[model samples]
Target: MVQENNNKGNQISRRSFLTTGATAAAGFMIVPRHVLGGKGYTAPSDRLRVAGIGVGGKGESDIAEFAKGPADIVVLCDVHDSRAANSVKRFPKAKYYKDYREMLDKEHKNIDAVSVSTPDHNHAVQAMAAMQLGKHVYVQKPLTHDIYEARKLTEAAKKYKVVTQMGNQGASGDGVRQLMEWYNAGLIGDVHTVYCWTNRPVWPQGIPWPTEKAEVPKDLDWNLWLGTAPQKDYVNKLVPFNWRGWWDYGTGALGDMGCHIVEPPFRVLGLGYPTSAEASVGSVYVDEFKQGYFPDSCPPSSHVIMNFQGKSGDIKLHWMDGGIQPARPEELGPNERMGDGGNGAIFIGTKGKMMCGTYGMYPSLLPSSRNKEVNVAKTIARVPEGHYVQWVNACIAGYGKKELSAPFEIAGPLTETILMGNLAIRSYDVRKPKASGNGFDYPGRYIKLLWDGPNMKITNFEDANQFVKRNYRDGFTLGA
Candidate 1:
């Protein structure tokens, strides 16, 4: 049976309802019928009433995956109606809204969960708002644009006692589990260094913003699309995908693919916050003699090294993007592909090395012959239904009832670790007028940034802290 709100006609505000729920012994006024009926009895209201925040592109796919499970996509929201057309068509019964805030505010009581697949900048605010209303949330990867936002969302998940998951589906895959088993069996013993690389930024980067402004599409709510980002005129072609190149809306390649590529090592090694970070960015030459550094844009490429003090020992992880790759390992054949040709990860351990592609797929230990020789008992349960279904099942199972593969508790730290590379990339461009007045002095260059993981600050460089937590534009805030 569908869970009925005990306070039917009272129409209590979402905040009041949540507060009452917290103080109540049951912890929730609307208990699922299954809980009352005991095990083996499926409730008619067991179907999760899901609301999607950005139903376009990846958002469309995310919603579709949820819909495949015992979920009803009741509300579909997107800043650009044109971008959301596909999802709207798929779920004709779903109520449509251009603004997520309005959708969440009006539908908070009706919806069971929210799936946030919006731009990086808007992720934290939307997810936090839903969590505040006591709704479970599944946010897309690179969980938030900034480290502080990632940290806040992580804390909010626990505070609200909501089932949370980040969109890095690889966390739910069997490949990561296979790798974990291999590592646990002492096949790849004590990984000391790791390399993750991606050939991204296929979108334009290392360039200035377009000078020409374009008229906003009639179907697109430009301001709503901007969300917490500073108000700016809509630029042509920035909406669909190219925004990944900019610092304001997207997090460049690191944020784009880091979650997928870095997740394996994090999961396998039980990694945590890094102690220090440093980076070198590739520059785009504007002229024969001069190179340009666009502060508003991410560099064309970058190589970041982060040092994590693990329980076993210190780990040095290298991140390379924009076609940069590490040297070929001697164990693999000369013709063997390194990192699935474009994006992949390599783990160097005391015993051997293993590599995998994005989403932890195609895991293979060094020396292909070892694959047949190694056989270890599977210790980790596999999410065969996949990442989205795992989250949906967990949400239905209620908070603290079932284990999630990429719960915010795990994804948040992974996101923070991924974004720390971006901090180094942005800091690498910090410059001031030189004392001689001939050229600018890049003070951020050639310095290792010491980090206080618990505090979320760069102890060595004060200026770098600005990127740790961005200032939300007027009206939007990461409310406590």
Candidate 2:
């Protein structure tokens, strides 16, 4: 299924300018707007070429989205051979490779865009490489593993002048659009607080420590799976999907779901950065917590709180999961059901309220009065039709914000918000003594997220703030 055709897009200077040698985040000395497409990068249309990394699970669906109309899936990439094969089967017209970096270099000018659906740890690395090549990027959500990376990805996309979209499809969906529209329209007067959660325990939660290394599957690439993370023997329990719960690969539950859960609030409120953040958990434990590594000071089942000093008011947005919810009202919709693993959110305003669960605020609005579900906002066309399509279309028709929603500017913060949960987990452990001992511990811990955009620090508490920017093993500093 390998393609042999040449690509068509011109090698326009990626965004405003950066010589392709700039390494750190803000190392270049120039006014950003002037140097980095002071306005925005011009996009290419007519004929678009695309590739996909991490071509398993959700990656499969992403392939189809990119292949719609005038777009060709040229290269398939993944850490595992099996995953890559699956992607190739879906797009029998594309070639396959295990290392995305190799594919980018070999394919060079052939790939115009790349879909990055790798593990949370690899998103930035893979996506950043694609951007450096002047290829547009579409990365899956929880866009970054940490706060700094979120900003780094944004800066890279602008530097490369590529069209980009975080995998948070809901950002442009019908329900979320209403969640914010209602707030903006004053339907939910003076929003004060928001609570959201996802019921995700299948990925090794509620289980004891993994003392034994899982027999690495031959089909799996153990080394690739652990990219950038400290080396360790492969464990089936943490491979593929379960990694999300672990401190190493996935971003824990919050990292897994927060970008979607907390997004409505971030957008509706026009939130800047968290003022402070604190997390509490129930019996947190890790095989081993390393400094500079994830789980630095957090438990596995950590509940993180990100507090933002809103322009109009102060609010505390709570996160929870694992057989828990924000307290369901006695009633639910007729077949308008909420999965037993209740994942959703509820907003508390000065008057009445509004709530949406699991798939980004769908069910019952609050007050029951105005809570009636109508296509209050624009309809969200499901996957092959909705989010993914929107991103591709927008990129093709330059200046398509409404089309390619969740661009870097918006996605950067969304990813930063979710990473708080991951970092918070890094700040707790089941056997270790309490961290930031302000009486905050697993089962009943609270760290408020304080946003300090100027400093790029969380300013919640010195102990917690230090965690926001973890020590990268070495040579992996946030490419500045």
Candidate 3:
């Protein structure tokens, strides 16, 4: 038989549980029902109770992976009911909520961990809220939209003593370990330059917003979906995937694929923050005769150059998106793929070069013969169960008990480095009216923006500082 709390007079509502001290002083223990055998005791369970914030698209896959591990999907929340339908069906016993705030307020005590897979803009606030309640969090790639948010989350993870992992699964793969081993063994002697390229933004970009407002889907909560962004009418095709091309919601190609493609070089080189950054974006042609720039949307393509100070020396990393790729190495055969064909990263060092594809797959030395001749002992341990299982186990083991590959301490700086490239991209669009009143003068072009990483600011270009931290809409904040 299970014990029950019969003290109705002392019972406190879930909303007031975290705030009220009376419940604690009155000798009322807020233990889960399963652990009611005694006070200050926890029932040993192999499962971790998890609540998913964005249960659709990548969120759906994230939850699915967690379910395969030691997690029990207890609650599902999404602004769009239709988008969350599959996850709800997969975990029918889980309660559902449209708003994350309501779910956290009522279910915080019940949930042991949270998986945040929402848009880039809302990630920080939602993850912060969960961390504030002492819940472990696994947020998707490009941890936060702004640099300041990344810094805050990194600090909070330590302050709150909660386990955290970013959803850049490549960090857990064996390929990266191989690269690290090769680097450590001096196969590629002191890397000085790197190139990471991606062919993303398959959706619409460099276009004007829809002129007409569309009716909000009956099953969708528009306000909740636009959590931190300014209120705007719902637009067709933006809900599920197309949001990546907009500055208001996504971090463009860099945010979408940077973590997967850049993680290898960042990890192998042991980089901190970028010291300077610059970029050149592809222009959009409105017609056969006229070219224009869209400040609200990400350009169709871009090439960002960021400099990082490494222990060996200064490292220069070039990021190319929208199908742009670096020149092929002359030592390779003509038929050999430059980096898994379309998306990959290359490291240029003093002695030789090495490259790999997205997710750190297919790492190889410059010449095909060198890869076969060189074999370095593995120095880094591989995550056998992969990234998702790694996080689930880490959360269960408690903070500081298990090592996470992409903890906020690591992922935060990686995300900040990736987003720093976007600052240069956005700054390239800063314009002022021309003196002759004919066109606009672009002041941000042809200038390298010096970065002060610790302070999260652009020292050379003051206009670029606006993007370091964004002003959140009312009712949403990076919680303290």
lDDT, candidate 1, residue 427?
76
Deviation of model 3 at 250, angstroms: 0.5
Candidate structures ordered by lDDT, highest first: 1, 3, 2
Ranking by TM-score: 1, 3, 2
**lDDT tens per residue, model 1, 197-292:** 999979999988888999888988888888899888899989889989999999999999999999999999999999999989888887777777
Please give the lDDT score at residue 212 for candidate 2: 81
lDDT per residue (tens digit) for residues 239-355 in model 2: 567776655566767777777777777876787767666765655443455122223222335566778788779888888866556665444444544432467777878765777
Worst ten-residue run, lDDT, model 2?
1-10
Q: In model 1, where do residues sit more than 4 Å from their true spots?
A: 1-42, 428-431, 434-442
Model 3: per-residue Cα lDDT over 48-92, one tens digit each: 788999999999999999988867899999999989999999999
What's the lDDT for residue 74 in model 3?
Answer: 95
**Model 3 / residue 320 / CA error / Å:** 0.2
In model 3, the runs with Cα more than 4 Å from the true position are 1-44, 428-431, 434-442
Looking at model 3, the pairs that clash are none
lDDT of each: 0.86, 0.65, 0.86
| Alpha-carbon RMSD, each predicted model | 5.1, 9.4, 6.3
